[model samples]
Target: MRCWCGKGNDTSVKTVGVCVRKDRVSPASSTGVLLNNAGFDYNVTRDRQSAIIMFCHQLNLSVMINANNPDDVLSGQNVTLDSRDIYLFSPYLVTNGRFSSLTDWQQKAVKCFNKTIELGIKVACQATSNSTIAATFNMTDLFSQAWYGTAMYNFDYFQATDIDLSGMTNVVYYFPNLNMNYGTTWQTPNVQTNALSTHYYRQTDTNTLHVFGDGLAYGNGTLTQP
Candidate 1:
C-alpha cells in the first residue's frame, strides 16, 4: 500500500492513487543553490550572490527566480555600475554628485577632461623647459614655449640689467617727453691731438648730471642734441 504524491494533487481532497508526505523540506543550501534551482548558473559564492542581490535591489530590478540565465542579464548592469564607481572615485573626476540633469553631468565631464589635459600639457612643458635644448635659447624664448607662445619680460631693474642684450640686433629706446626749466652745460673733451675720450652722462635732474664711461643713460628729463 504505497502511495505517490503528484505535483498537481490537492491536499484537501484525498485522491484514490496519490499520497502526500507530511515531513518538511529543508531550506536551500545557499543563495547559489536557490538561483541554480531557478535555472541560473550564478557562481556559488556568498559575496557574489550578495553583491548581485544588493545591486539589483538598488536599481529596483526584479530578480526573477524562474527566468532562464538570470545572471547573464546582470552582466551589462554590473559593468555599468563598475563604470559609475570608477568615475565617482577617480581623482581627476571633479563633481559634486548633484547633477541637475544629464546635460549637467556631460558638461562637467567635458570641463574636467579639458582641465586635466591642460594640466598635463603644463607639466610636460615644464619638464621640457629643463632640458639641454632649452639652455641654448634665451629666457624669453623658453618662456614663450613653456607658456604657449606668450612672451615674458623681466620688469625688475636688476633682472633687466642682468640680461645681456649686446648680441641683439636693432635695439630701440623709448623716452617720455620732458620739460626742462633750465639749460645745462656739456663737458668739453680735452683738446689733446690723436687722443680719444669717450664719456657717457646720465641726467638725473635738470640741475645735476652724472657721467660714466660708455653707458647709455635712462632718465625722465629733457636732453639737448650733442
Candidate 2:
C-alpha cells in the first residue's frame, strides 16, 4: 500500500487507517452507510485510545509493536532531528511518554504494522475503505518513527543493557538538533531510525504519499517505498 506524495523524491508519506472523524470517508461517498467513521468523539484522548484498541480487534490484532523488525515501508533515509523538527512549545497532544535527557535514549525501536490498511489502495481496489482507524503519537513515544530510541547523536551517552541486534539490515541513525551555546550542556544519543509500514508521516493531502530525503518518503525502489 504506497502513495505518491508530491515532494523531493515525492516526499512520500503513509497514513494509518484510523483518523479523526473529520478525515473519515462519508457514507455519501459511496454505497455503504457511515458506521464508525462519524459520530465518534475522536478528539477526546480517552475515547481515542479506546477507539484504537477496538479498531485493532476488528482488524484481528492485539499488539502495537506487532513484530521486532521493520516492514521497511519507505526508504531508510538518515534523518537528523534538529530545531526544525522540534519546538519550544508542544503541540496540542496528550503524550503517553517523554524523553527529557540522554539517560532514556539507549534502546532500539523496531518496525510495526498495526492496522495499517492503505486507504488509497482500498479505495482503488474497492469503492472505499470504511473500516477507518487512526491515531497520532508523540515523538517521545517509542512507537513513533520520530522517536530517537537508538541514540541520535552520541551512542556513548548511555550504557547499553541486555541488547539484541541479531537481525537488522542497513541500520541508520539520526543526528540530533544541537545548540552550541556558550554555557549550555547538551548530550544526546544517536537515534536509530526504524521502519514502519505506515502512512502517518511527511504528507497528508488527497491521500498522496510523498517520499524523499532525511524526513522519509522513498528511495528509487526500496522494497517498502515501491
Top model by TM-score, which number?
2
Off by over 4 Å in 1: 1-124, 127-142, 149-226
lDDT of each residue in 113-222, candidate 2, tens digit only: 11112111110000001122112211122222222221122111211111121113222233232211212222222122235422222211122122112222321101
11-48 per-residue lDDT for model 1 (tens digits): 23223112211222122321111122211243223333
lDDT of 2: 0.20
Q: Model 1 lDDT vs. the true structure?
A: 0.23
Deviation from native of the Cα of residue 62 in model 1, angstroms: 41
Question: Model 1, poorest ten-residue lDDT window?
Answer: 150-159
